[model samples]
Target: MADLALQFGGDLAIGPTGDLLLSEGTTLTQQRVLRRLLTNPLDYIWQLNYGAGLGKYVGQPGAPAAIAGMARTQILLEAAVVASPAPIVGVMAQTDGTVNLSLSYTDAAAGETSALTFSL
Candidate 1:
């Protein structure tokens, strides 16, 4: 059996003409970890391990709050993708009343490093 290919947006490749777009190799792996982190678990019937539901972590943006949320976020990501190293998570409070989630992790299998930033 071959591994399935999926887009970061969770769209399996379907050509415009309704044909399956078969992605391969590095193209299939790029951003895969990040996408998994962005996905919320149980959002889909077929994929129960899809995401960490990071949106739920949105909360008051203070040093203590950020640290606590960051810890939870790291645990969620770790559970979601065991092959990836425990993520380095950082939080920044914004003047606009938003919190920034900054994350970086290395894929254990590919040795690829990824960085992502999200505002909540």
Candidate 2:
């Protein structure tokens, strides 16, 4: 089954037909991965530990290694990512207080590699 398509920041996506879009394949996997990383833990009532909560690090001390490790672990938990070749996570803390996150992983369902870059 496909999920309602969502933009990077959780906005609803519109399809060419003037209706809500649905996501599948690589796009779906990327969306799910982003959601997992951005959502705060315990925010989702049913699954208290479902998220990496990357936002929690904002305005706090810089810990690129720790953040990257956390992201890598979270990415591997997704079913779409292959477990053998671990995801490569890069976290860069900018002078302006924002953090850049980059990752590359193999998508199990699509049998192809994918990369995502975003900020926190």
Candidate 3:
């Protein structure tokens, strides 16, 4: 959610006349989007969280021991996904149930493109 978090913040826009704006619907340039994508600091944290032990919480508690926690996490994670407003910017997941990952975007440059893919 890090890059997605920032990308949500990246909310760059171009004014009808031309200028840089932010998520508030100002105006911005193509360069600003790229800048956000390249420099946003969250990429590091995003990678770690997505690639590591995200499974512990999957089990969570006594909702039901029989209920597969990993499966549950995957389901909720996926749901938080489609329900998200911003286009997904990036993702990382481990093959084992040990890790799962997702990204949600809040801000998106007009014409900007994004996709979400998962493995595990």
Candidate 4:
């Protein structure tokens, strides 16, 4: 099933036809991955453990390795990602306190590799 498309900041996307955009295939998988990483674990009532809660790292002492490890673990939990070739997660903490994250993974359903990058 296709999911309602979402912009980078989690806003609903609109299509050219004056309707809501829908996402599938690699795009959908990527969206799901980002949602999982960004959502707070306790915020989702049904599944308390569903998220990586990456926001918790913001404005705090940076631990790139630990953050990367947490991201990697969470990415693997995503059903769309392939298990054999684990996802690659890279985290960089800047002097200004912004943390950048990069991820590379194989999309199981699409049988293709994908990459995503974002900041916290």
Candidate 5:
């Protein structure tokens, strides 16, 4: 079975005269998973207790504890999702107090290994 989903956060009206953007094929599925993993639990409509976004680590000093907390959340989120096999998640606190999140996963359907990085 082919898994598919509308790209998450496709609300931007950047088309010619403002049309909602869309993603198809494996890209759509990948975007959905990334959005879900990055979203804050209750921030999205009807999404309660569902996200790996910042968590309590936000606003706290970017210490080891803070980074570890965020990493734990990221790992949990990846495990909860079904798009990819177990992912390798890395979290690091930058000098400017931001966090660098790196995620690596093997796309079974596409038969490719992919890695993504985000600064939060």
Candidate 6:
């Protein structure tokens, strides 16, 4: 694959029509899942692999905590990965099996798992 960048530019939004608005960037190129979006304008949140971030987690504003400031979790059920940005593409699965997708988050000592169950 060619070296490229995928930008997710936007606020913490699940768009008026349900589409998510993340940030714009150069590192998020040709990647498909298994990543995180940390430290938006939010507080009191915790997340695990492959989800949108809203706390003190990654990168630097030139601060170690200001990477891609905002993003939305691409839960298989929340929304489908129709298409990726320019120079970026997702790795399509090559089998028919249980696509077990799970997401965990904690806030104020309380935690929950948001699952996006689906079939192949």
TM-score of each: 0.50, 0.92, 0.20, 0.92, 0.61, 0.18
Superposed model 4: Cα runs more than 4 Å off: none
Report lDDT per candidate. 0.55, 0.89, 0.32, 0.88, 0.58, 0.28
Tell me the tens digit of each residue's lDDT in model 4 across 36-88: 99888988899999998887876666578768878989999999999778888
lDDT of 5 at 68: 51
Residues 5-119, candidate 5: write the lDDT tens digits: 3444544434455555455544654665577656777887785866656545645765446555554455545433344456667777767777777776665556666676766
Error of 5 at 72 (Å): 6.5
* 1-120: candidate 1 lDDT, tens digit per residue: 224567566676776678776654334443454465456678857878656665565564455364545444644444223344566677776676666766665544446665666665
lDDT of 2 at 56: 83
Least well predicted 10-residue stretch by lDDT in candidate 5? 1-10
Give Cα distance to truth, residue 31, candidate 2, Å: 0.4
Q: Distance from true position, residue 45, model 5, in Å?
A: 3.2
The residue-by-residue lDDT of candidate 3 on 13-119, one tens digit each, is: 56466755333221222222333333323455655332123323433443223223333333233222232453433333333433233333332333333332232
**In terms of TM-score, how similar is model 1 to the real structure?**
0.50
Which model is ahead, 3 or 4, in terms of lDDT?
A: 4
As a TM-score, model 5 comes out at: 0.61
Give the per-residue lDDT digits (tens) of candidate 6, residues 1-120: 222233234234464666563333212221223233322333325632344442333222332212112222332312223222211212222234222222232211112222222111
The local distance difference test score of model 2 is 0.89
lDDT of 3 at 65: 32
Number of colliding residue pairs in model 1: 1
Per-prediction tally of clashes = 1, 0, 9, 0, 0, 8
Please give the ranking of all candidate structures by TM-score, highest first, separated by commas. Answer: 2, 4, 5, 1, 3, 6
- Candidate 3 has a TM-score of 0.20
lDDT ranking of the models: 2, 4, 5, 1, 3, 6
Model 3 residue 107 distance off true place after TM-score fit, in angstroms: 4.7
